[model samples]
Target: MAQIVGIGLLVLLLAFFTVFTYYAPHGDKAMGALAAAAIATFLVEALQSFVIGDIFSLGFFQEAGTEAGLLSGVIVAFLVALTMGVNPLNAAIIAVSCGGIGLIPGFFAAYLISFVVKYMERKIPNGLDFIVVVIVIVPITRLIGLLLTPLVDASLLNIGNIIVVATEASPILMGLLLGGIITVVGTSPLSSMALTALLGLTGIPMAVGSLAAFGSAFINSTLFHKLKIGNMKSVLSVAVEPLSKADVVSANPIPIYVTNFVGGGLSGIVIAYSGLVNDAPGTATPTAGLLVLFGYNPAAQVIIYAVIVAVISGVVGYIGSHFFRNYPVRNTDFD
Candidate 1:
């Protein structure tokens, strides 16, 4: 029951944030801000671990690292605040007050604070609004952080563990289901990286999920290119990020989903059956993740299997896409 609730909460939070930041009114600003925060925090965190931590041999950035900890929090707070229309000085102050929290909790805190600030901006009279925000908003949101962070962190970890257990229990079945589901979400407006990281998905599970995403990208690009459904550049760009060609995807979502499902399911089966593993998080381009398979499997075998998966998925996507003739391609600018 706890596991179920934790997983459910994680999914709900992911969906809520994705929709609120991407599809809601004036959401582009929020999305942009979120993107900026993610990039800043994730990049710095990755570099500190992959580079600085390695050199220091102290793991100086492994989530609780002293040197890189507060820096990430301040960056997230500053970007989120500026995006919410706070002045630089106030943004700095608020950021410092929040201190360092983990990414998931930090994001929640940033969103809550921003939401409240935006609301108060409209509701409060101009004469004393800044003073009110500085005096009240910062402390209140920080308190919320104090209350929510531990719960969110523990729940997220539990959710990850639950998924790990389920996958281990029935690797083939869970792989097929999770692989397909994760790929669809990845190709959608939601960020696959964020989802995987949030769930702490790694090893074989990561391999399955990443392959599923790659299958979708390969399928979409191949089918669109073969059919001349959209401009070549636009169609090919789907290989990197499907959302880049949102119009094409929205028009023919069924075919895309079907192809992704078939491709992802098959790849998941292969990963589970062959015992492939990957410790690294997947890249934006799914195929890039196949390289990690080499860590556990032979290089030649990994490459061969990857090619076969891509070819099969592409063929399936191409054939399945023809069933949706009602959805015509819309004109789009490559730039």
Candidate 2:
């Protein structure tokens, strides 16, 4: 309960921070959406404690973490529609794709950057070398979890030996300490999803709600952006991409970025509570991190939650792009 309060406070502060930062833009809609997300976090947590507990088994936690990813898909939907400049009437497509393929953009964008820079590296002319970022590309950011997974079991073993040596002095503290040590060992960031499975602690349904809100907003953005769709043309033969060109979808990524954080984080917290942990050795990131859930035997509520997130993501992305801000990319004067 207290944690929910803490989360609400953080979201509120974040909301103010977002608005203050955008003071020049003064986006009332964007600001309002942030406020809504904060309120949502509070309501969802409270509901999870009372209603979900009354109605369903906590066994749903097994799917919480995976479920969170659905909301992030909205961000993907927003980006895709913005990039293509498709019209508002076509939002359904954006919603569908975002729900279906939200993670591909980031992963592929990273891949494209890598591929292009690497290709330019060998082909750069001597005088042109400085002008080109031929070598300035790295795809797939490394995750900390991947590198540290090996030491998990061995470290636990060493701690167990230490506890054995201390047992004669004060067994209670030693036992307490031992329990603490094993708990840490069991919940290693890389391994907790599986550990949760072993413990069978089906957490409440906070995570599913998180997923639902995220998906809802994402779908909302997608549909909204679709409604505002336009087209673009390059004035220059070779494009001079800006530092933040990644944001130059047919619309901007600002709204989507904000949406992803709120939506994604909520989903993550829910997953943690739900007892769903990603067991894959590598960092559970990108879509594969969560979409992997589709493979799991999810609680019935989670599937519904996913569909909702998809719809919201599309809707939010659409409205956010068209209503709040206009993109320069959609208005290039090629002539």
Candidate 3:
């Protein structure tokens, strides 16, 4: 029950933020800005967390982490600005104020600060605007963040713990449930990388989640091609990112989602059955996840097993897509 609640809360948060940030009014601009911010954040994080810390075996950046903190503030500010539909100056002010907060809290803080700023813009007099906005708004936003951070962080940690415990308790059942859900979320506009990172899922559970994503991508692409639902290029691109074929996905959402569940469930069973484990993040793709399997199993065995799973998943997805065959395809510009 606790595990269910944890997973449920995580899903609710993801879905809510996704809609709020990407599907609401001004969503296109917000999404574009968010994407840019995500790229900047990923580059900095990879450099600090992976390239320097993991590959170089250096502690220079690790010891002096101030740069990362500053970068995070800038990125969060940019995101807040985008969300608020404000100019750069206002964004910088809010970002500086909201610095040192985690992603979820930062998101809430940005919205709250943006709302207050908008309200003040309408209500407050124009005298001493900089001080009023900067000194007043920034601290209030930061205070809200400071108050919310502990609660949000504690909730996230508890959810992560529940996922870890649930996976350990019954790898197969949890694997199936998580595998299906994660795959669907990955194929959606939301980031699978972000989702996994938020949950702090690792080992067998992570392996199963990654494999499920891989299976769903394979299934989606293969079925798309075989059914002529999309062009070859679009179908192939679905493996890397399903949103590339958003037209097809949106047109046949039920079929695609259901197929993902079936294919992902089967893939999860395979992971549990084989007892495969993946510690690496971003294993939500077949190439990335299967390549990592080389570390734990023989290359030939991994290749063969991956092939078998892909074939099974593809076949299952193909069957599932047939249910929506009669659904009309709507024309939309992917350009």
Per TM-score, the best of the predicted structures is: 3
| Candidate 3 off by > 4 Å | 14-23, 27-76, 115-133, 154-162, 188-190, 219-238, 241-258, 281-297, 325-335
Q: Could you say which candidate leads in lDDT?
A: 3
Which model is ahead, 1 or 2, in terms of TM-score? 1
What residue pairs are clashing in model 1?
none
TM-score to native of every candidate shown: 0.65, 0.29, 0.69
Each model's C-alpha lDDT?
0.60, 0.31, 0.62
State the displacement of the C-alpha of residue 335, model 3, in Å, after optimal TM-score superposition.
6.5
What is the descending lDDT order?
3, 1, 2
Query: For candidate 1, what is the TM-score?
Result: 0.65
Looking at candidate 3, the ten consecutive residues that score lowest on lDDT are 42-51
The local distance difference test score of model 1 is 0.60
Tens digits of lDDT, candidate 3, 1-335:
77778767755754554455434655444444443443345334434543345434568754343255345434755575656665566767787776776554665576667766766666766545546778788888788778887887676675566656767788777767677766765554444544565565667777787667667777888667665666777777777655445334544455666678778877777777776766655445444455555655567766766776788787887787676677564422341
Q: Which wins on lDDT, candidate 1 or candidate 3? A: 3
Clashes of 2: 43
Report the C-alpha lDDT of model 1 over 16-114, residue by residue, as the tens digit.
Answer: 654564455444454445545544454344344423443345553545333443455566666667776766665666676577565445545666677
